[model samples]
Target: MEVIAIQKSAFDGMKNELKELLEMTEKVTRKYTPIFKAEKWLDNQEVCLMMNITKRTLQTYKDKGLLPYSKLNRKNYYKLTDVQALLEAGQPYNTDGNGFTDQ
Candidate 1:
């Protein structure tokens, strides 16, 4: 068996690696935590961030009732489940009732 010397650089490298591992573990843990999933409703900014959409696009959805929402004190709140279902359902572009693109 050979003796391995522990140096400051090696120790620091190990510490950094451990820290990175811990951070990744925390991220994975947090992903399945109930606190994250407890948010049944989402505001506009959160919806935009999750859907990678601009506020204008979100407004368009709201205008067309594509994304169901409820207003509380004049503020709109969308259901997270509904948003997820909409994504899973793969909604198509709206038509102008005459089979023409609404665009």
Candidate 2:
């Protein structure tokens, strides 16, 4: 049964402060948020299938630094963007219908 009241001017100021705080919070979150979620990732099998190459070829790409990837728990993962870049750069794979790729 508390009848205490805050002044309208005071309440307005508090509301404005809350709004500012929320805006700042949003800005901070947006700035620090990791972009990994927005990006697409592929595994070794998927990359091999997409590029029509073998696993050895994919490993060669990794060894030659033709593609960028992330390794987790002893498994290799690749970014879709990097794979696309490799495809766009040139034909790094064998065009002679071989099962391997160019070193």
The model with the greatest lDDT is 2
lDDT of each: 0.79, 0.83
Candidate with top TM-score is: 2
Candidate 1 lDDT for residue 10: 93
Q: What is the TM-score of each candidate against the true structure?
A: 0.50, 0.59
The superposed Cα distance between candidate 1 and the true structure at residue 58, in angstroms, equals 0.5
Residue 32 alpha-carbon offset, candidate 2, angstroms: 12
Candidate 2: regions farther than 4 A off: 1-35, 95-98
Candidate 2's residue-wise lDDT over 1-103, tens digit each? 8798999999999999999999999997797456557788899999988887778878788988889999867998898999999888875767345664444
Off by over 4 Å in 1: 1-39, 91-103
Residue 21's C-alpha lDDT in candidate 2? 100
